[model samples]
Target: MSVRLRTALLPLLFLAPTLSPAEAQSGTRPQDVIITYYNALGHKNYAAAYALWDRQGQNSGKSYAAFKNGFAQTYATYVAITGPVRIEGAAGSLYATVPVKVTAQLKNGQQQSFCGNYVVRKNNTGGSAASQVWRIDRATLR
Candidate 1:
């Protein structure tokens, strides 16, 4: 019985070393960053949502105050990842394009729809550890 138990546990030991605790905790995937951004917005956590943008929200093209105020008339928001996220590497960095559909429900019960791509990026070269994690670089919505 001990021999069989050891055999069963052996595979798990091999797999354990392949998984990194830091990677899991960092939410490095591009899709995860997109989801987290929208979820924060939906919950009205503007600061949390804005910080997901690159350059600490500078890449979002709006000041933190303006970004928060843009949603003043929005009662809630929803997002659907409409297609597969694609990641490409360039200049020692990874860029991911995530296609998404979003709906914003206004306080007056009006809904606005947006379809666009969010370009997320991660620095693969030299930077702080936090900079290595994915962040929204830019968004093109219509």
Candidate 2:
């Protein structure tokens, strides 16, 4: 029937990535990068999580100062993560370099891509500078 065909084909239609490869690699999806950083922040691993931000991101409005302050607010919200975050096509070439994919979701409560996609990084020295493990998103999830 027409209804059945449209329903079946709707999923394939939304599978397409809205942004280009470069944009898609911005890094802020899934549970790997951002979530890990969230956990580190929650655990008071400031040194470790702070190192995960990209150079550009650190320079943006999301600087170290902003991170500390914003984290305080984020912690105030949502009690805990509900379930396992699903990230499609997650890749890490090395300890510092990782590529993230674009997120997808349906209008209805049918499907949703794990919040974001980001590549996490570590520090080089005594908080000397934030290394590049993964890029960052302008939006931070709780």
Candidate 3:
């Protein structure tokens, strides 16, 4: 999808602002975070995309430059969520694994599809109400 189209659709993707305390306490799903990540990627907003990664991804031997450069070879990329993302949670754990099917279009005019899982963890360190957020810790793409 084009950047403009993706930008236009972002509002539709995230219908609400911050998650209510009730929703957060019950373990909110990471659908919005995942979709927004894809939106950043679709727009080729490397900085925005990289910012979605949790602390785990940041310290995973790949620097911010590498993370951004990784997409340099791709063009007109589109990430589609094929179905409802299933998030598995454990009692008292702040992390969840979200499995999803994604279709991507590469710059080589090739399309790649994969069933992968994104590890998302919630953090509440920031001072604002919206600071409590779910972030992508790692991605197992195959």
TM-score: which candidate is best? 1
Clash number for model 3?
0
The TM-scores of all predictions, comma-separated, are 0.80, 0.34, 0.66
Candidate 3 backbone collisions, by pair: none
The Cα error of candidate 1 at residue 93, in Å, is 0.9
Indicate the TM-score of model 3.
0.66
How far does residue 123 in candidate 2 sit from its true spot (Å)?
17
Across 9-109, the per-residue lDDT of candidate 1 in tens digits comes to 33422221222223322765677787777767766889988888989899999999999999999866777789999999999999999999887767776
- The 10 consecutive residues of candidate 1 with the worst lDDT sum are 12-21
Error of 2 at 68 (Å): 0.7
- lDDT, candidate 3, equals 0.61
Between 1 and 2, whose lDDT is larger? Answer: 1
Top model number, lDDT = 1
lDDT of 2 by residue, 46-131 (tens): 65555545565463356666666654523211112344443333342223322333232223323324333233333323333233
In model 2, what are the clashing residue pairs, if there are any? 27-117, 27-118, 28-116, 28-117, 28-118, 29-116, 29-117, 30-116, 119-134, 121-133
Model 1 ranges with Cα > 4 A deviation: 1-25
Model 2 scores worst on lDDT over the 10 consecutive residues at: 73-82
lDDT (10s digit) by residue, model 3, range 1-142: 6666546545543433334323432345576676667666666776766766766348334888888788776654444455556555455335666676666555565667778777776654445444456777788879
